[model samples]
Target: MTKVQKGKLISGLSVGKKLTVMVLVMLIPFSLITVFLLYTLNRFGNSYNLVVSNVAIANQYNLEFREEYDSVLYQMVARSITKDMINEELGLTNPDDMTENVRQSFDKLVTSSTSQNARKSAESVLKLLTTLDNRCNDINNNIIKGGAYDVNMSALDNDIRVITELIQERISEYIYYEAGSMELIRSAMEAERIKLIRAIGMFFIFFFIFVLFLVIYLSSAITHEVDILVGEVKSEQINSRNLELKLLQSQINPHFLYNTLDNIVWLSEGGRKDDVTGIVTSLSRFFRTTLSGGLDYITIKQEISHIESYLQIQRFRYRDILNYEIDIPEEFLGYRIIKMTLQPVVENALYHGIKNKRGGGTIKISMHHQGGDLEIDVEDNGIGMNSEDTANLQRLADGLEKAREDNAGFGMANVGERMRLNYGPEYGLKIESEYGKGTIVKILFPKENSN
Candidate 1:
């Protein structure tokens, strides 16, 4: 029972054990009552049958006594000397036969009778029958010796009548006692039936109420816990997204800066002072705007400035091989965008597109408004991708591809996921590429002013 309490004890039990306890709690009482009730009913049936049989036996004993007594009285009054009468009395001449008859009758009485008093009274009646039978034999012998008239059978007749009345009284008492005992047993059976019904009914009512509360308690507890878990998961996801965004914003592209510094060193060795100054200044401005005071979102104007610095450095390094253009309307420059959104696309064009082409190519950055949505496209006329490579790039940008040590795919995927998380799924990166011709990447988001 202690295991059923809502605590560590109940949690320790398995599902099967809990169900077993519940079944036993209700079933054991019912089983006990059923067994006891059946036993009582069986006892009542046996008693009822015994009483009926004993009553029938008593009636038959009375009838047999009356027939034998009347026959002897008629014979003695008429002075008859019938052979059948002499033979009937001669049968009682053997004391063993008389004793055997009494024994058999008493045995039947003992076997069938339920009450001790009833058995004792039946025993007395059997003894009286035996005595009366013996007396008749004496009267029969006297008649046989001196004839029925000289026998003086009045004494025998009176004796037989008195004994018959006594036997009748005893049988009546035995039957009355048996009837009373049967009535008492029946009353007890009725009481037990009522008690069983009440006990079982009360147990079931309490069990039902307990089960109702258990269901309600368990349901409420589980539902409340599940709701709390979901809330925590959502909160964690938002925090993780913000942390990742900050980490990405603080990251400076070491490879690009390293190559630019190497180019600056080469130019310094060649005595190109003005070119070194221009590259160093652009690199400074690029890193400054990329950090953006550690904020996740920045104005459209700042977004353009960072990408312009990046393009300038690249153009200085490539000289006559690489060219680029930016055509964002002034009216849209005050609007907001996620920081570092365009720079990664511009980087992808430089490394994967324009860098791969033999003659290099032009990279174009443009912006337009369609309905309430703002769209920015980065198009490159360089060595673009085939269908498979385009699909692979899309997978990387969507974060379906796992990151490896040397992979540069995280930048595009991070920017796409950030926009989606901030605004919704409707705003993210979309890619269109044609094999060996060009590639265009479009970024879409709702038009909102900088705050």
Candidate 2:
């Protein structure tokens, strides 16, 4: 739907793009944190309920175990008493041995039952078992030896009952302690869940506020720059046509014109009227085309003719030092270009590249229509430039701030600026050069924008 959704806004987009990126970055972490917090809160709430339920279950189980242990202890005591009666009736000689066996069996049962509960419960059970064992030993000794006939059986029964009560009390105490601790844990978890929810809410609010501030600041900055650029473009459109006219008029060198006129006058006085007439006719045609600023746009054929006239005048000046040629498709003759645009690039190749060579060089100009663009190239096999000279030429295309003392030139800057004004920034001069080889100047314009 949008460039950001397609991932194309990451690098190439403007300030608005940055806002989208920031929002995305903040939202991912925010969503993750929100999900984690909700999960934790839900888990904690469930765990607290589970712990409460388990505490209740443990209490019920402990009560049942305590009741069962009490019944088993009572039965063990009854069995011990019955064994003493048998020993007395049989006149057993080793009653102590039988008593010890019974004590051992009772201890093992008590230990196994108490292992399920806490420390207090186990200690209480052990104490109860030890007391019962002592009572059994006393019964065996008294009945077998027929001594202590006045012993109280009620005291022994009361002692066993008291031990059973103590064991139950210990179990109750443990259940109470565990339940209290679980309640405390549930309270703490509830408080922590509340705090986390608040923190997440505050984080979202802060994130939204920061995004709002950033978007406002970026919008203002981008709008200001765009407005300034629009104004500059409007100003250029208003002034460019007049500037092109002035440049065309200034193309002719006044001193050269005067000298040529003098030569024609001298030739007329010497009876070489035919040669004088030919020079006059060429000069007249050249000035007429150069000064005609009525039409701001003209066909490629017309611009090429204008350049031919300019080159002929230069050829008269540097007769053998410069050679020129042009090749254009017949179909492209009707295609239009800004007036006087192509000629200046060729002039730059002559003055900057070939004029300084000793043996002179050939200048070849060619043009053709590509798919959606026009390609024009001016190449010369003259004294080519070094890397630094090429860089300097590039700077001149933007308008020379400071003239180079070594290689002073003018046509490159004027031609480049005119091209930019006429056909946007894309259409301009591109220079390629290599030292001791040659130089090529290329001009590109849109085919759709032609006449």
Give the winner by lDDT: 1
Q: Which stretches of candidate 1 lie over 4 Å from their true place?
A: 1-250, 449-451
- TM-score, per-candidate, Cα-based: 0.44, 0.42
lDDT of 1 by residue, 358-448 (tens): 9999999999986788999999998989998888778866645533324555567656755654566678888999978999999988985
Clashing pairs for predicted structure model 2, backbone only = none
Number of the top TM-score candidate: 1
Residue-wise lDDT of candidate 2 within 260-307, one digit each (tens)? 778777778889877677777777766666666544467888878877
Native-structure RMSD, model 2:
48.8
lDDT against the true structure, per candidate, is: 0.67, 0.59
Model 1 RMSD in angstroms: 50.6
